[model samples]
Target chain A: MNDIVLNVSNIGKHFGGLQALENVNLQIEAGKTHAIIGPNGAGKSTLLNVCVGRIKPDTGSVKFLGDNLTGRKPHEINQLGVARVFQTPEIFPELTLLRNVMVPAFAKREGAFKLNAFRKVDNEAEVRDEAEHILEDVGLKEQMNGLAGSLSRGDKRRLELAMCLIQHPKLLLLDEPTAGMSRHDTNRTIDLLRLIKERGMTKVIIEHDMHVVFSLADHISVLAQGQIIVEGSPDMVRGNARVQEAYLGGAHV
Target chain B: MAQLWHRNDLLLMGVFTLAVLAMPLWLAPFGAGYPDLLQKLAIYGIFAIGFNILFGLTGYLSFGHAAFLGVGSYAAVWSFKLFTMNVLPAVLFGTLLAGVFAALIGFISLRRSGIYFSILTLAFAQMSYNLAYSVLTPITNGETGLQLTQSDPRIIDRLYVEATSGLPSTELFGLKMSGYPGFYFCAAILIIAFFFSVRIFNSPFGVKLLAIKSNQTRMGYTGYNTRPYLLVAFVISGMYAGLAGSLLAVTDPLAGAERMQWTASGEVVLMTILGGAGTLIGPLLGAGLIKYFENVFSAYNEAVLHQIFAMLPDWLQSAMVFVVNPFVGEGWHLTLGALFVLIVIFLPGGIMEGIRRLSSLVRRIIARSRRDGLQAA
Candidate 1:
């Protein structure tokens, strides 16, 4: 569909004798937060990895905005407006928070890679202003000069979110963003995700936290044993008998 | 104000330049012998600085930087022999050729990072050495080495004298030195190279290089194609090595395949690490220390040792000679190896780190003294 930002069809990934992921199908629209919830070792990360072109599926197709993303390199996939945040906050640790955000801004502004050596970065006033705005959005304006490595965990995740969002990607894939956050920080993250969605960006969050999934997910897909057990609206998935049996520890629905 | 100065990479560079220029004067008590050592130190300093940019900042340890340096020297020598005898063309050609060589190597080496990158560069450098030694005999002049002929047909030399009278004993702009002008010329070029390095280090590109080193995978996911950034950095560093190579030929005007050898590449790595891998001034300090051992340590002979040892009893002197023997005598490599091990074990940050720590201590003392003075006032 024209509004579909990402479409994964019958994707499967296998590593020798072990199956990492099995027949999975997912569809994300242009401006929605789609959460994939699964228990430990449920292939939520592998699915996200496949979406971001970090790993190739043994069989299947990943389509983003009508283009096949299956064989493309991660950077190439990113250039096509798919930004991913790692399970761990992956940022240039030694660089300042401002510079970390600037990396994506540079890529987006100067298509692919550029050798813009002689031009001063400050001379590009627009990009710098936009980067500052991004930092402001992520609540890191005060710590712009602070090294990325020195930031607290929540701030690092926020900084990374800013980095991905600054690129203005059509789709953002987040892997366990609130995995290690405290309840306060997790709620703060849910609020951030709400703000991003409210601003009209599509996101796919692979989260183990059921509260986060139930609260933030517009559409929830429950994964089990490397395959999609069920996908429906958050309340429907939360109420599904099979989802309860497979993922919700067979709890009463 | 002091904090601002320290934060400003350019200001630090200017201070470094002033210190480097004034180095010979500070060691003037050691006289002409020391200036030559200082010159060698500065030359290798530039070499190590370039190598450090590629390896230290980018974390792409290259075991083949000598190939670029050696080729750069060859380019400079060729420029001197065929075109202008002036150092400018030679240095330019040398550095540009190094960049070109780096582009080719980087294209392939960038395909694989980590250990594979190191092995690829090493293999390529070895290939360059072999080509220089044998197949490229016409250009590199084979085993005998590429040097300037007394009957060189260069236009810059022709402009100074009648074309009929020929090369005019290789005087630089009519100020004849027993090659002292050549040495000074090299020093000036090194100064320029150092300045260039400072500009680059402070640039956005330099920051990106550091980022690439930190997490290339993250960079890639962040919509950055890190390969191009890495390639550009590789080329820039290669050009710096080229400039150093050109300066080497300007001082002595001889380029040999030995300069491209794996051991030579290994030396630059040692220099950079010994000085301080990531810090700006570390490579220069490391290069200076290693080159000092190569030149000054090798200069000490049995007669000089005897002259110093004569004050002691004959038996005791013999024992002293034996004790001081390996480091002072023919075992200069042993001294270098020992120095390397000592630096690695104790001062891994190299001489630059040692200096930084010393300066910090001084600063702390100054701050305490100021506090005391303020209370008294």
Candidate 2:
């Protein structure tokens, strides 16, 4: 129980008549990369959304570090040290890269609400330095002043990762972090994830890319049709027959 | 970056202050040096600045801001009637009352966003307008509106001096709030409002508001409570509108229900958008331009047109008036409408975009000339 950073038990959700998720259970271990992979319309995203408090589940609850997060607000959950990187890189497109990173840092430092209307954001030297350092770590230091909206797809994803990293989250959730990246960028991201893994931060990555999953995940959960088909070490999941059948039945993810 | 940004902001503020203080001199050539027009420019400038905080930054459009203005006006007049002839208390009370009212309205309106929020604000303002016009006639003074009357208990003013010759006007200490002194007073408040807006634009709170505008979903997951930031912005802007309305009452003590009318609310929206929503100085420019058009341009008649086209032949002059008549005088809205359409289509950033384009064009020209000179050498 101490080793489990996030616990999802019997999370069931439906949209109208369509059963998106039913009797779902997941537990992410501390200091390990857990990958949730499934085919399209498998309710993979819905399950992720439920965990993040974006969608309220029909049944059961989500617990983070033994605290109930089932019906809590998204920001409330985030302030509890959970950060999400969206598939399409939901970022402040108009803000500069540095400002984008600093925003999340402020959120972490100031909590859910701070009446900091008089103090200059630039004057927050501690947060600014961390943001700059993180941008440098992500190899975006040269273009830190450029608007995030003008970034390439891969760069935007990288910026989003930097934004999350600045929060120093206990549980980092990445939704297809390399969704629109080129092969070269994907490989680069894999190396970056490997570096993050070395830091011992627990991460839950939702990915369709097997290369990414195999390269980064220590633990793998094979979700098919809103249910986990196989859950074990990466090697065991790779050899599981149910997982193979689940993938082969559809255009393989 | 902080030092450089601060210096740039300071320079802008300095220039703005100089421009505002010297308005009478600079505007004299254009026949807008008059006190009444100058006061309007300053008051409306403050209104636009506040409106931009909500609409431009957070992308929340409240179509009932003029209701706050009306609230401010009524509060200021009541202060004058009960407390003293001093403008200080009236201004403070007006702003405070407007802020409290905004807190109530924003709490409800902010529950919805986008067009729903705009509609909710509009409905609230209209309700306030009708109530003040009819239902709350005793307090609001109904169709006659709230005005200074000799028979009323002046309270503080009465204690100082017994008996009044006629109706007493508003004042600041001993300084009369009319003509040039009134313009200066409004200008000072406008400057203070502009400075606070500058601080807000630079603050973390401001960034969060922008984040809310850019991607609210991301802000939620980033752990920023968006509603409180939005409500604060709403109250601040509401206070700004209230201040503008109070200044109106200060210069000419009258608080009519028309101040809360939807058209007044719509006018502020036009000012903010017409200038540039997000930019610091843009809304002020928009307010000045709209106010100029409304006051100066609308004052033009066929007589003024004849004066302008006097160098031409009689027939040509008459023909010119016929062509130009619709765009000036009573048809100033036609001119304003055409200008607004052109601005929305061509320069969506309002006048600021045009300034930026011009400055960049000049910079390119200078850079090319310098490069050519270097090559020649």
Best by TM-score: 2
Candidate 1 CAPRI grade: medium
Q: List, for all models, the DockQ compared with the true complex.
A: 0.51, 0.86
lDDT of 2 by residue, A83-164 (tens): 9998789999999999999999999988999988999987898988999999988889999999999999899999999999
Q: Candidate 1, residue B116: CA error in Å?
A: 2.0
* Candidate 1, residue B18: lDDT: 75
Model 2 stretches with alpha carbons more than 4 Å out: A248-253
Write down the lDDT of every candidate, Cα atoms only.
0.82, 0.92
lDDT string, candidate 1, B255-296, tens digits = 999999999999999989888987777888788777777766
How many angstroms is residue A31 displaced in model 2 relative to the true structure, after the best TM-score fit? Answer: 0.3
* DockQ, 0 to 1 scale, candidate 1: 0.51
Over B54-144, each residue of candidate 2 has an lDDT whose tens digit, in order, gives: 9998999999999999999999999999989899999999999999999999999999999999999999999999999999999999999
